[model samples]
Target: MAGNKQIIIAIDKDGYVKAEVSGVPGPDCKKYLSLIEEIVNGKATDETLTAEYYQQSTSSQNDQTSLNQQNG
Candidate 1:
């Protein structure tokens, strides 16, 4: 299960409401922060990013070698 992530939203005790995302790559993970802004009618403003998420999205694409290997 590589490249898989999850986002969580909830309502807490204080009536302030809450949203928490988990299981996502770090850092750039916050790039998705705006996704939750619509909840609770925009009562909150903040975001967090972690390193592990930023590091996981790299894709290795070798063009000629891939074709050559495919042919072989």
Candidate 2:
């Protein structure tokens, strides 16, 4: 798969937890992050978007285009 994804989780000495998602494209990455949030039982206080976060896969783009054409 072109968009092979991973989530990295870490905990500090004070017990603060952090998670980072990589290799996922577009808004779909949030689903993985949300799963991490549930495991940590906390809301995100900050976020950093990577290049992949802003990149949409060709399949997703085509799906969106098809929907727009159908609705329009």
Candidate 3:
């Protein structure tokens, strides 16, 4: 699980839903989109990935090690 996940949702006067996710690193934010879709019973027609989407999670970063370590 990512740290401090947050989802901000807004609906326009025309009933168009827009959702933004924060505090979640990497593609993990997509999970929240599914949750939002289930709640609203609607599918997302567009998506914009933020900088956080390209960032590695803390856990994944910590799990990586130099190849030299494998020979030890």
Most TM-score-accurate candidate: 3
* Candidate 2 structure, TM-score to reference: 0.64
lDDT of 3 by residue, 1-72 (tens): 546666777766566677777776666667676677766567777777655456566521111101111111
Cα error, residue 11 of model 3, in Å, equals 0.2
| Number of backbone clashes in candidate 2 | 0
Give the winner by TM-score: 2 or 3. Answer: 3
Q: What is the TM-score of each candidate against the true structure?
A: 0.46, 0.64, 0.68
Candidate 2: tens digits of C-alpha lDDT, residues 19-52: 7766655676667755776666666766666554
Candidate 2's C-alpha runs over 4 A off are 56-72
Error of 1 at 61 (Å): 24
Number of backbone collisions per candidate: 4, 0, 0
RMSD of each: 18.0, 13.3, 16.1
Best by lDDT: 3
Would you list the clashing residue pairs of candidate 3? Answer: none
